[model samples]
Target chain A: MSILEILSYIGTFILLINTIIYSISFSFKKEAYSFFCVYLLIMLIITLLTTYYNSQKVNNLFLSHYYFLSQFILLSLFYKYVFENKKNKLLINTTLILIIYFLVLQYAMDTTLFQIFNLTEVVVTSLPLIIYSIIFFYQNLNAKVKFIYINIGVFMYLLCSMLLFASGNLMIELDPLINKIVWIVNASLYIVFQILIFIEWRKNYYRKIPKSS
Target chain B: MEKELLQEDSQIIVIILIAIMILLLMAVALVVFFFFSRKKIIATELEKANLAISYQKELLYSTIETQEEERKRIAQDLHDAISAKLNVVSLSTHVLIDGTLDKEEQAQTLQHILSVTTHTLESSRRLAHNLLPPILENFGLQATVEELCDEFMSSKKVFVSYDINYEDSLSKANELHIFRIIQELLNNAVRHGAAEQITLNIQEYDKKLQILFTDNGRGFDIRSIDKKKGIGLKNIESRVDILNGALSYSSELGKGTTFTINITKT
Candidate 1:
């Protein structure tokens, strides 16, 4: 297996472990963490499908689009869950508007699913998500909220991935080698993001244990 | 065509390198900003914690000093009031026991011992009453304060006028604290302020007990007075704190002094 494939497997393994841990720890309390678990599960499945399709020599760009779309939707849902109790109408409305915009743009522009990565789609979706993450940071800076760590994780991941995909299509057209390298960096950042989520889950697990006892 | 493609590729590499440099710089700047802000927040929190600790220490010191002063006062009262009179009684009894005198002389000596014993008993009761007045325990804060005012009035030392408008009484523990605070204030006015006339008013307003103590005396500078140096004021302060009350005092040199205290009802 190639180095990229190995890295991909590692990312998949981390996601799988994090999902299982979250499931076991918060099985009965699903409302609080269901969207996050779904995000993790979808990421794991996408990773596995991409790896299998690569080995079988089939075109899997559709899976890549699916990966981005599913992540945008599920991560948005997760954030909505995180801020469910907050009484800020503006933030909720803006998030809803951004999601609608993303869907409309993807449906209108993404005609050929097997074609190159939809750089426009990635940029459009990521910009608002990045803004939302920043809003989350600002809103919770002095608030007595427990989801600060997860918010930071989400913010950093969006920031790095936004920049990575902003220049993605240009690099793909220019040089496959550089494209591969950038994708590797993206994968590493995603793995780090997964680990951050795992840390948040582990914190919740330990926090609940004492209460349960 | 091949040469042109190579040139184009080199230019793209330069651009990518610049982009990567910008991103790296941004990342470094962000990390630095996060750490710097975090350090500032931690420092502010540490300062607040330190301030709270220092205030608590000052309060503890004041409490300890007040206890020591109380012990000294009790010891002095016992020595001067009860102990000295008891000694005189003992000496008289000893003379009676010697049996060197006539019957009339022995009878006179026994009479003298009885008189001394009666005086000593009164002194002991007075001291105990001063320490923790039974009037305060049974009759409540109003009667206790009124009795105290009457005692001062009858003493002809200082003319004290007081008004008690409070209808409800406090818990026993809180009543004791309030009584001590008033006693300390009165003592300070008489001893330190050297006041000839004093007015004390206590009333209940808006779920709070407001106490106003005013004295017309040779008042000293409120700013110049060291709170810790005068155990009387410090004792009052400690009691006010125990009662969860707020106290403020204003004094003008050679004019007068007024102390106001407001305690929230429990």
Candidate 2:
């Protein structure tokens, strides 16, 4: 196989492994915070499937659906977990309802309206969700060490996604160096978030010292 | 389809390399952590074992000396009290048997001799039993505890009761240590507390064994007693410490006193 094909396969495999580990961690203790783990696991699985389909050269409407839906799902899951739980039930519920509404709108809007606006509203609205996650990280100081690492990762992801979107909108062909930076950031954020969250979850769950001890 | 997708973006190869590097970092961190923690755990266990061995040696020396001293005291008590009394009664018996006397006078002398002989016998038996209850050496802790309760009940002085709920067979050394602890507590209750009622309980659950002793007595102020009666309490505390157990005391003046020790079976 060519280097590109080999790389695509390796990336897809890593994504699958990350999903499996994330799924296991999410299911281990069934804590309220475990919602984040489940969300990450789902995102990883969808990412894996999309990458595999893209690598296999099945570029079609399904691939586009997979691409947008996974991103939307991931962003929604992230926000819900960051600020949900009993303490912020009102915030959590409103955010969740809005997420579901936007997701349904993406799929159910009139063909003419969709053609006119395309996915512009969906993409634009996601910026605030991502920013809110960063804000939530700042607000939850007890979640500092864990959230700081995640904040750096999510910032990199947001930055790259925005740059890619802006570049696409302008119909500008960016230099290879910019492409390389985006690629590195995207891949590192994916891998780093998986590892960091896994470690944080393990620390919160399995490594607890009993009161007796 | 394949051609169009490949032509679109060829940067994914860089992403793959970056993922591999992150995985490598995590694996390295995990291995280092495992080795570091494993080494520390082993060193800690080693230190603990060494400390326990040294503590055991100190206990052994102290216990042996205490036993020797106890044996000497018993020997002196026998010689001074019971033996001297018995020797005097024996000489009196010989004098009374040899004397030529009338019937009424002979009967009076014989009655006196009989009373003295019986008293000496009773004193010797009581002293021997106090030194080491034969029941304890023969039938183990349970029978001895029951014997103690029976003795208390018969005397009608202290209302003492005992219950044993141990399922596992104890090693001889363990049983002996537990027996001595109970013996000492009872002595303390009788001598100091002026206790009217006392209870001893032994129970085992899961991997733990517990012994509880409670007494209804004119209990002393723990803070005040602790200052003066330090040695007795210290001995109890150290023995429980050696067993890697916990010992707790709850007492109130005019209310009651209770001592409980919980230890691991293994």
Q: Which candidate comes out best when scored by lDDT?
A: 1
Off by over 4 Å in 1: A1-42, A69-153, A166-178, A191-213, B1-28, B94-100, B224-229, B264-266
Candidate 2 error regions (>4 Å): A1-213, B1-81, B102-115, B224-228, B241-244
The global Cα lDDT (0 to 1) of model 1 is 0.76
Question: How accurate locally is residue B98 in candidate 1, as Cα lDDT from 0 to 100?
Answer: 84
Residue A13 Cα positional deviation in candidate 1, in Å, after optimal superposition: 6.9
True contacts kept of 1: 0.06
Q: Write the per-residue lDDT of candidate 2 for residues A142-182, one digit (tens) a residue.
A: 32234444444454455445444433322224345435544
Residue lDDT tens for model 2, B1-266: 85554445444534534554564555345435544655666677788999999867766666676677788988898887778877777776777778877778778767877787788778788788876777767788787777766776687778887888864367766776677677778767877788879998998888898999999987778888765553456567767876778998989998889999999878
Error of 2 at A55 (Å): 68
Per-residue lDDT over B127-230 for candidate 1, one digit per residue giving the tens place of the 0 to 100 score:
89998999987888999999998887787989999999876468889988888888888888888878889999999987899999999987877767863346
Q: Where does the lowest 10-residue lDDT sum fall in candidate 2 chain A?
A: A165-174
TM-score of each: 0.76, 0.39
- Candidate 1, residue A77: CA error in Å? 6.8
Count clashing pairs, candidate 1.
Answer: 0
